[model samples]
Target: RHDKLAVNYMAMVKLAMIQQHLRAISPSDRT
Candidate 1:
């Protein structure tokens, strides 16, 4: 159970990082 939770946490963290990177890049692309 602990291992599963850790995997989920890591996945979420990676997803958040990707989302933040996309958001950062998108604005530059618009202009």
Candidate 2:
């Protein structure tokens, strides 16, 4: 049970990181 929770947390963290990276990159292309 604990392992499953850890995996889920890691997946969420990676997803958030990817989203943040996309947001960080998009503004530079506008200029």
Which numbered prediction scores highest in TM-score against the true structure? 1
By summed lDDT, which 10 consecutive residues of candidate 1 come out lowest?
Answer: 22-31
* lDDT tens readout by residue for model 1, 1-31: 6999999999999999998899897877666
Per-model TM against the reference: 0.77, 0.75
Error of 2 at 23 (Å): 0.4
Clash pairs, model 2 backbone? none
Model 1's alpha-carbon lDDT is 0.92
Error of model 1, residue 3, in angstroms: 0.6
The CA lDDT of each predicted structure is 0.92, 0.91
lDDT of 2 at 27: 75
